[model samples]
Target chain A: MDTKTLCDGILDGQRRALSKAITLVESARADHRVQAAALLEALKAAQASPREALRIGLSGTPGVGKSTFIESFGMALVREGLKVAVLAVDPSSARSGGSILGDKTRMELLSREAGAFIRPSPSQTELGGVARRTREAVALCEAAGFDVVLIETVGVGQSETVVSEMSDLFVLLLAPAGGDELQGVKRGIMEMADLILVNKADGDLKAAANRTRADYAAALRLLRKRPQDPDGFPKALAISALQEDGLAQAWAEMGTLADWRRAQGHWARTRANQNRHWFMEELRLALLAQLTQAGPVRDAVARLGDSVASGTTTPALAVQSALALLHP
Target chain B: MDTKTLCDGILDGQRRALSKAITLVESARADHRVQAAALLEALKAAQASPREALRIGLSGTPGVGKSTFIESFGMALVREGLKVAVLAVDPSSARSGGSILGDKTRMELLSREAGAFIRPSPSQTELGGVARRTREAVALCEAAGFDVVLIETVGVGQSETVVSEMSDLFVLLLAPAGGDELQGVKRGIMEMADLILVNKADGDLKAAANRTRADYAAALRLLRKRPQDPDGFPKALAISALQEDGLAQAWAEMGTLADWRRAQGHWARTRANQNRHWFMEELRLALLAQLTQAGPVRDAVARLGDSVASGTTTPALAVQSALALLHP
Candidate 1:
């Protein structure tokens, strides 16, 4: 489709076209990217800006059934008549440049739902399973009218925190296992979560789940924290993804937290801060590229490193001399 | 030697000189950094290139015996007549910034030893419990012929991971009470740890310690990991820090792991990669500063973001238009 007609359809709230356009943008071909960019521009011009969707990032330990839970939880939300989009980034091949992108199969129910949009992205060895295109994909989802964007990360360290930067809510899922189970995972994930859900909370596991929740709550008291969470309060809830219990409460809790965030102006302020950081990061990449290509500095810098390595010069003097030339 | 002469004397392997120089390098003042950089250059020149040191990073959940174990471990090494430098970053300011550098006090016996250097640098809210200059301090220690440079962190979530990045071996010290205590931590730590020690394994906790180690060993089997770890095999060991039992075994395990890693070429490759990453990161920061100031693209980009917000343009197009002027 031509950019003009394609964008007009998106503005008219045609979900299918929106999906197609997002796919085009996600494609790696140079031509497709150019065409996709043009379509996005036309779409932006024609539509009144839709409400930017709420982004939530979910991360947990592997084998904790992240996809199964997202599938069930997403289906629950769709049943409530809310439009949802799920972006699942696979973390299996983070050290290597491979991704399983298995969410589509794992989340068949949600994937097949007419109102639910499920896209499984490869982390591509990104520390967080959030590829470079993720933030832009998010904008596209919002443009297409996904009220809720659920990003499911391959349960890796640091990726959840990366997702937290892009999302409005960060939910850390824990299995109903006790202190012994939680002890090896390190204290990192706990501090990042605005909400903690003890999954596998069913039948005989209820008491264990409750105890885990209480223990976590006590632990939370000791952590030096900010006043308001991305979600309104510090909430630890119990849910059974397998049994599909407490799912609605989880959804409601998310909504309440999101509302509280918006009311507190945290929603905008946080995004603004993220935007600034992202911009800085982008500029950093661009400028470095320019500097490396600009002049005699590049050659001089490389030679200097060689000298420093061979014990002929110092890294400090090399950097200083290189910077002087580049800036000059 | 006084601080002044000692700072200058660090040019040689004088312990006092090494101590004074580290303090100045880690000092927060602008003038101190200038002095530190100069001293660093001279010291780097005077010392042998790449001093042989086993740089280990120790981190765990709060209440875990990190210091207790380190002291026990350090004392074990000191008794063997190997010089040890413990850069124990103080965490007294978890809720505030004041610090007493009191880990030396925690490990009372080791603190009194002439062969051991136990200095608790303040966390001071740097990237991790590690002060920003901690890397420089580590460089200083390595230059002065310290056999091992041990970095102790505040055991916070993201901070622990960051601390692990600077060390040759990352040891995660976990408590011995192991009835499924793994739920609290995300699975990420498993990937980062070169060694896992279940501490407090003496007395009544012995059974629990064994069980915890068993659980970790089982879980590790499930992970398709790097062909080799920093500490050779993926061995889970149990140790009683209080009783000072398993010190030699633990140290041997660490040595065996390091040997395995060196045989696999990971030791050299890992450090080289880390250095490359830091260079790239520093380049990014320097580039961002220039990019924000050198081009009109910064203004154009911000304006474009506003257009996207106001429904006048799309991000894809904004990026394109902004980049077009990047050449000019």
Candidate 2:
């Protein structure tokens, strides 16, 4: 239960300790947060692990067979002598007070595999807080000798984009016959998708799946590609999770893409950028929280906010006035 | 002129004083900034200007006939007994130590018009700083009884988005035979465009202009409409600045859109939001500047930045460590 024991157990690949460590980081209690931070610091400093895990983010709409795809994909990795870890991020989980474990029956095989670890999404209230904890969980998993970490999230709002930032490869799963309308695909999701997979390519859906793959491929070609993408442009493929088909092909493509990125040094650069981004974000959020607590600063924003609302003051000038109070 | 006299002269529509006031705000000198801010405060608090101007943003590629279109548009407005002010925003002007005065010859008629004010883009090093000065210049023009303010910028980088935020309506100008390729359009510019105009539609290019308009209209249909758009999706049209054709139709569309937005309360809401956004941006910039100035904070960042680069530290934890030093 102590930070040292929990960290040691985690480093030793003890499932119980890993679960408990995740809970500690996800906890809202002040004491738990302090202890969790200490454990993370120790784990990070002591981590001399030989090889780092591939952090993959998988996002799909409901009924896209995300759970089934993850199960099959995870099992494939485990079959290759790799230890896999799955961490789900569902911001809407707060509404139902549920995690992705609501249907653990779907991941039966992978859940029971000794080589794979499936942790339910944390039931955290804030998106940023949940994302931070999940990112920390990834570190623990890496230290615990997990060679592959899979992040699963539903394609909704900004959650997918946030998840994509912490990932090395982002895979977007789409169901066959899901209509290729640009309106159907949110702009943010389309822009962030590093690869597109048309799921349910088995039986009657085989032709439809191929058509969907073509449609997505064309869409990706027309869309502006990410500047940091070392693999040129995002490519689309067809897969059937029900039959456990195309899982190996998808995995191979991911490996090739990852390999190219690593060779080009973009992988390291991107990881460093993510760290710096998160660092600045945390600093900004903390500073804002502190600034709001100051009486004079609060008063300034309130008064200036009203003026700005009433069209009496410009935002730039209002900011100037507010900054004066903060630094004075 | 002193701050008070400059403010008074700006209010009185004295061209010399108005130019001087704009120069003051655009100046990087410390004393000039203090004086500029004072003048803005005085102008904002004093001016009970009747009927605010319609802020219109115009952007296009370098050879998209932006200056010709603006000259025609400005002339049309002035002929209608409305005083128009055009403020150009060229962030790259800092590099060449130039504004768009090269086009002054092209805007000869409008430049000599008594009812029009044409100010070239200020040569500012920073985008935010330039944008802030431009916003202030907008307020000064409004106080000086300009009934229509036209903001012109090349559709490059973030300037288009920044200009769009301050404007009541944003118009994106294109040329005939421009191919209308989605890949050619920047995603940010496409998303923010309230109106799409295919300029140079006169004579032989008329057919191509119509085709470009139709293509853009289809593309616009596919884009997710802005949530705050009370007038629905953006519309596309073809215009000819050379023959001064379609100017009236484009002007009428803007008028209708502006009228609808104002009636729906989105006009005021959007302006207030822009103010709040700028206020937060300024606060963040100021906090960052202050943080960098402190020796302890700078030293911590330098150490953590190295760790981040060397892959030894996570960005979130680095931020936490950095915050501790700040708050301590």
Candidate 3:
């Protein structure tokens, strides 16, 4: 299909067009990128008034019940007659052969919902590439009239932070555990989180979940409060995705926070900042890509790199020589 | 001075020549950079055998007694017939008018010592420029026959991690406080630390210092152990800069860690990796600088950035337009 048809289908809320557009954005081929750009531009022009989805970024370590929580929470939104879209950004998928979200039955009920759209993480080798594609996928979902876009990333090296950049709200999901497991979470991630949800608050884990919640509550208090949030935000709460308990309350809290941010004008300001940030980031990546692609400059970099590594030349001197090769 | 005279003076451990050479490297002028490169190359060729100083990176927030600790530590080393050099990398100095180490009497005794050399943070506007200048100054110190080069940076923002990149070992200094102050410490910095020193362990605060040390010790245990270290490494200890207590022990511990790394060949491997990392970093900075320096491209970036922020264009499409301006 052409760009116009894709834009029309997307504006009409057709799931098939959204998927096709995402594939186009994720494609590494030069031709596909041109088409993807055109399709996105066409969609932007076709919309009468810009529609936005509440982009929520969720992250948790493996076995932390992330998928279960997402499915439970997504169903709650769907029950309220809202359209939801889920996009995963898994940099590790390239190495693991796309093991994360690879199984189709992982979110069986949510997948069956007509109001819900689920897309697996793109199998991109670099985290930057994966994040860029996922960000575009989010834009496509919003253009397709989704009420909410849930971006999930494994709570591993750097991916969660990347996701947080593109998201309005960053929710960190944790298991019901004490300080040992808490220490495993990077402090940087904790600082970035807008909310911490301690899952497994049912059966034998109820007390443990409560305790974990209190611990995180105290920990969050110790962090310097961000000026953008209202009082008592970046707090922790307990939820049970298994029994579907506390799901409504968590959803309500998220709504409250989102509404407050929107009213306080933080939502618009933050989105604008994010857009500018991504534009600069993409420009930097493209320029660096040119350096690596040029055969002569690439070879010169490698040769000078070896000399620097072996201590035959200083880094500054090596860089000087490399730049000379580029320009001269 | 010419490159030959500077090389001879550096090899002879002349403090004036070392300072001049650092000024050369730190200069942003095109002519100065050429001369600096020539001077560095000459020094590299003059040395009969490469003599390296044990580089230690120290970081602590303001009011953490960093200068006091450095003074005491440097005095101790000087008394032991070892030449010591101290260099500060304070990126904040650019805005603060070099307030961090602006006072000439900050390390009065050490500054007066014949065996100790001290350099304040470079007054560069950007962190990358400041770090690059500091790294080259470190080379000058090593060439001037210093036995130990102490690199100090304020424990705020990304400066500490940048210091860790150039040093053989990274030490985090903390005040005698509890969880509140600990929370202020970024977890990323904690992971990078090879040693944690709780300072002001004297008078009324001795017990508090010890307790803080224990807390950090436990926290360090929770972090995954690094393979490069021997057992019981990256540990915390209490020290008193006022009374000069524990300075010898801290020095001994640093020696032990450094010796272990050298024995395991990690020292050489790490330095090689650092060299290559800096080379690539400088190259990236240079390429990005070109984008900002070109008048047409810079203006286009600003115009496109405004469009992106105003939601008039998607970031990817804006980037595409910017790239076309560059290549076309």
Candidate 4:
């Protein structure tokens, strides 16, 4: 379809059109990129007023029941007449040959819901590309009138941090364990989290779940409170996806936090800051790409890098030589 | 002094010459930078054979007794007839107007020792500058026949990670505390550490110190082992810097780890990789500097940044517009 048709179909909340638009954005081809940009611009222009979905970034270690929690929580949201979209940013999928959310069967209930849409994106060997495409997809979903957009990433490496940049609320899901398991959670990730939900809180794990929740609560209290958060925010709660326990409370807490942020103007401010950050980041990446576009600059970088590695020249001196090649 | 005389003095292990050279490297003036590069080149050329020092990066939060530990450790090394150098990288000092190691009286005994040399460097508004200068200082110390160089940084922020780039080993110093305190320690810094020492392990705090050490030991074990580390590496131990306990043991462990790395060829490989990393980083910073230099491009960046922040256009599109201004 052409850009107008794609924009109209997306604005009407057509699943096929949304999927096609996302695929276009994810494409590496130069021509597809141009078309994708046009489609997005058309969508943005077509809207009488901006429609924004609550972008929730969710991250968890492998086997943390992320899909189960999402399925249950998404079902709850859809039951309230909310349109939900789930987008996955699995950078590892490019290397591992499988996206974590590649199989829709994992969220069978949510997938069957008429108000829910799910899509998984591959990293394509660069995190910046993945993030940019995913962010664009989020815009497409918002244009499709989704009330909530869930961005999921594995709790490894820097992907969660990247996800947080595009999200209004960042949630970390964890399996119930003692302090040992918490150690596996990077403090940097913990610091980024607005809410931490300890899954598998039912059956034999209930007591352990409570303990982990308390531990994280204490730990969160020790962290310097961010000005964006209201009082008693960034706390942990225990939930069981299988039992459907604590979902309501979790949802309520999320709503409260979102409402407070919106009231306090942090929501708009944060989105604006995020946009500025991505703009600068994209510009930097584009500039760097110029040096590596199958040119003499690339060759010079390699040659100087070898010299640096061999200790024949200092990195500062090597950088001076490289910059001279660029500016000359 | 001229570069030739400076090189000769450094090679002769003159403290005055080493201090002057470091000041030159740390200067922001263009002329001084050129002179610093010349002096460093002279020293590198003058070395008949590479005199490598065991570069140890030490970091801790304020009040972690870093100075005390360094003092005792330096005295121990000096007692064994080894020359030691301590370099501080305090990024906050520039803004705070107080260097953590500005007062030589903090390490009174070590400061008076003929075998020890100490210097503090300010961040000067950019971490890249601080890291570059500190790395150069490390080279100067090695050239001056120091057997060991300790690069110290406050445990907050990215300074420790930066110091780790220039050091052979990274050590984290912590005061006696429970799991709650450990939660305050960013996991990224912990992962970078090869050794963790719980300081103030004497008097009333000894028991707590031992417990903290064990906790970190467990946490370290849970972290994936790096290939460079030998078996049972990245361990934590308790020590009393005030009482001078465990200093010898810590030194012995460091020596063993360093010797193993040298024997296994990781030492040279790591340094080469570090050099390559720095070369690329410097090149990236230089390219970015070009964009910020006085020109229409800088003005365009500011204008486009405002537009992006206002959400008038998408970041990708904004980047395209910015890049057109550069490459057109």
Report the number of clashing residue pairs per model: 18, 0, 0, 0
How displaced is residue A20 in candidate 4, in Å?
3.7
Alpha-carbon lDDT of model 1: 0.68
B1-328 per-residue lDDT for model 1 (tens digits): 3434654565445777887777776665545645665665766555556576898988777777877887889989999988788885544453453335456678888888877787766556545324445666777777777788898875655656656666888888888765466735556776777777888888898888888988887777566467665423566788889999877888998888888888888887776655544433433433344444535656776775665444455545655565565544
TM-score (second chain) of model 2? 0.85
Report the lDDT tens digits of candidate 2 across residue range A76-111.
899999999999888778777656557366689999
* Per-model TM-score versus the true fold: 0.61, 0.68, 0.71, 0.72
**How accurate locally, in lDDT, is each candidate?**
0.68, 0.80, 0.87, 0.87
Report the Cα RMSD per candidate. Answer: 8.1, 7.2, 6.7, 6.5
lDDT of 1 at A259: 86
What is the iRMS for every candidate structure?
Answer: 5.0, 3.5, 2.6, 2.7
Candidate DockQ values, in order, are 0.16, 0.27, 0.40, 0.40
Residues B102-205 of candidate 3: C-alpha lDDT, one tens digit per residue = 53488899999999999887887699888888988998889899999999998889998789999999999999998446647788998999999999999999
lDDT of 2 by residue, B102-165 (tens): 6567688999998898888887668877887888788778888899999998878789988987
Q: Write the per-residue lDDT of candidate 4 for residues A131-157, one digit (tens) a residue.
A: 888988999999999999999998888
For residue B269, give model 1's deviation from the true position in Å.
Answer: 5.1
Instruction: In model 4, state the lDDT of residue A133.
Output: 88
Winner of 2 and 4 under DockQ: 4
